[model samples]
Target: MKKIILSLIVFGATISLASAQILPAFQIGLKAGTNLSSLNSTASETFSGSNRAGYLVGVWTRFGAVGFNFQPEMYLTSKNVDVTSSSGGVTRAKFTSIDVPLLFGGKFGALGLGGRFYTGPVVSFAIDKNQSFDSAAGKVFSLNYQDQNFAWQFGTGLDIKRISVDLRYEAGITKQTYDGRQTRISLFNLSLAYSLVKL
Candidate 1:
């Protein structure tokens, strides 16, 4: 925890020093959104849909030009899965992760339209995991789910002045479960952000 804070401090200092001489093409923002998440695996299951509420708060920096930019962010995400059985109603499985993403974007502006296409990598660390099931006999299964993995993201956004709205899709490139099972997590996120400070 201390190390993470120190690293962020160092990163902020580095960015500050680097922007001192440049044209000051940097901005910071906060983001919040929902996540449509699920696991793609070979395990036998009877689940139909799994959508959950997730949010993120972080600072972002954008370099010059509407053509290319790099944005890095840190956020806390909540992911949940809903399962149903033949005789039962529904079950819920929830997981939380701390994620850091580094993204690159391309922007286009014309005809009163402005938007950007962005894609990048994300690293996540799981904080909690649990499952609940509703069955004929109220059957339940619980396992210590691991959620440390690297993920790839692709998305687009609209940028207007100090505010931006983005939609992104994320797919895990590495497995998260500890049982050597081929399981992957994916997220569809919508975020709104405001520029905290501009340089």
Candidate 2:
């Protein structure tokens, strides 16, 4: 019993020391953004759709010191898209999902202001029972059920003191179309984040 307790205590101390050496600072922040999204068709078919606007609100946490950082964020995002069929009918779809992103970044510059570039993978899970098809016209449409999606995002930002502004682009890797057709989500995001707590 004594040997086991000593080993556990030593292991915990080693882990704490390693963390203190590698990551000296931590921050928690709030972020809000606008999403300009479109439903894009695969090469085999043609899709007629217009870009739709949506909003995102989230909480994010960052760890590490000056040059390198790792961030994880959770967001409530509105994913809206417009689609038009060959029969001249339009259907608007609205999907609400929870998004989690793990980002690795590099920060540079001096003084109280700096610049950062980041890239990450995002996983999104749908919260609704079915993919809601709102307001449709022309022909009857069958909506695809996409409960989860995977995407990648890359962006650059300006970080000033406790706040940051970012411009990012995201591309969906998983196709979310029914009827043997391929479709994906693509979007541009502009966001502002404020650090609420620093440790």
User: How many clashes does each candidate structure show, in the order listed?
Assistant: 1, 0
Off by over 4 Å in 2: 1-23, 43-46, 129-137
**lDDT score, candidate 1, position 188:** 86
Report the number of the highest-lDDT candidate: 2
For residues 33-133, write the lDDT of model 2, one tens digit per residue.
99998877764244466788988999999887746889899999887776766655556777788989899997776555878889999999988633334
Deviation from truth (RMSD, Å), model 1? 12.5
Q: Point out where model 1 deviates above 4 Å.
A: 1-24, 43-49, 84-91, 110-113, 135-140, 176-181
Q: What lDDT score belongs to each candidate, Candidate 1 first?
A: 0.71, 0.79
Q: State candidate 2's TM-score.
A: 0.81
The candidate scoring highest on TM-score is: 2
| TM-score per candidate | 0.72, 0.81
Question: Residue-wise lDDT of candidate 1 within 103-149, one digit each (tens)?
Answer: 98766664325688888999888887767766654443333356677
